[model samples]
Target: MTRPRATVVSLNQRIRDDIEARIRSGEWPPGHRIPSEHELMARYGCSRMTVNKVLSMLAAHGVIERRRRAGSFVARPHPHIESVALDIADIPLEVTQRGHDYRFQLLSRRKRRPRRGHGPEMQVAGDGSLLVLQSLHLSDSAPFALEERVIGLAAVPQAQQQPFDRIAPGSWLLQHVPWTRAVHRISAVNADAEQARRLQVEAGTACLVIERQTWRGEQPITYVRQMFLGEAYDLVARFAPGRPARRD
Candidate 1:
């Protein structure tokens, strides 16, 4: 059954427009399956070829999802995103997924005053801050990263008894404590001998450092410094809908 060129083009445009209208109007919400090609062709008076092209193009643009035996569907919405959000690059996670080895070691814990030399962002009180715990994390028997963390004695009365041998402080806090507010800062730092030795990299080499602090209500909960070994890993992100653009 042959159709005129004008008729083919008209049918194609109609099918594309119909699908686009449904998406813009939210009839096809994210992750919701759309009609199959046969259904779309039947409703739009279009050829299967035209429907396939339209769906394939939309899927490539992150607007839809195509799965074998499942037909086409709107994509899953991304997660809540913040401006100047996380951009983690050069941290390796590939080898571990292959069932490789990983390990952690607790170095020391201390209580200290907010000395002026102790980095600017960490401006705490003179009554002395909570506990500072240091440790190293390894992958495949090679040093992977170093973790330096501060704990809120008031937030978690159990901080004193928190063991650090098998579990890194950052992981322990997240699993055992609860926080309401969190701040994260990422930067580059030169490795000191200790950091260098633990990471198995040359001292003074550039490393990615992430500093994060969390609070429960107005009370501080945790402060942490996480340093990655090198540029073998990076962060990928997805975002959800923003607060309905404020209407005047």
Candidate 2:
């Protein structure tokens, strides 16, 4: 009896799986060029379209990088930076994933009523009090980022009782609170004296800052500003065109 041949979809998957396996097993390290599409087509006995689709998928997933004329290569790793898409990340987890020890230090904590000069995020508290926190995130005993945050007591009353000494406020809030919407603002700024001292960088060094505010419906939950040494961080966003609908 003769065995049945694999379908086109299976062939594409098999080619993709083989390439990924080689890269993962260290057989094909970062910057190692992958075989050309023609070679893959011949090796798999598949069409150039099928091979191209597999390569496109790999590039989309960051498993490989394609050059205009040099063909594809295993993508180099980014170990110190964190990437996110439409979600908040726990800083501690980000550090650990980069193969470093993570530590959080709470620099200060204060409870006070919102005042006129306190900033717009504070106004969200209305008549309620605010829990303000400043902290440091360290990776392998080196300064990673500095965080300043304010939690609205009216929205999260439980924040008042939490010490926030052992855990960073952002991580704590993500675990305990439910936020429906969030806005992020990214900018570059020269580090001031206080910021430079805390981050252990030279004064006037360029830094990347991310400011975010989250809300649950009409109730504001929290607002935070995080600063990092520019070379130590990166922000990445990926997009692809939507597929056309199929017609029956």
Best of the candidates, lDDT: 2
Question: lDDT per model, in order?
Answer: 0.65, 0.80
* Global Cα RMSD, each model: 19.8, 17.7
What TM-score, over all chains together, does every model reach?
0.55, 0.62
| Candidate 2 residue lDDT tens string, 52-100 | 9989877765668899999999877555323334356688998999899
Q: Encode model 1's per-residue lDDT on 1-248: one tens digit a residue.
A: 88898777566646655675676567887778999999988877677898998787566545578999999987664454233344322123333564667677778888664556665224323244567788777777777778877775644545676677766676665544433345678788889998888788889988888787665334566677888855743444555486222211
lDDT score for residue 175 of model 2: 62
For candidate 1, give the lDDT.
Answer: 0.65
Best by TM-score: 2
List, in order, the clash count of every candidate structure. 7, 0
The list of candidate 2 runs beyond 4 A from truth reads 1-86, 117-119, 241-248
Alpha carbon lDDT at 200, candidate 1: 82
Residue 76 miss distance in model 2 (angstroms): 39
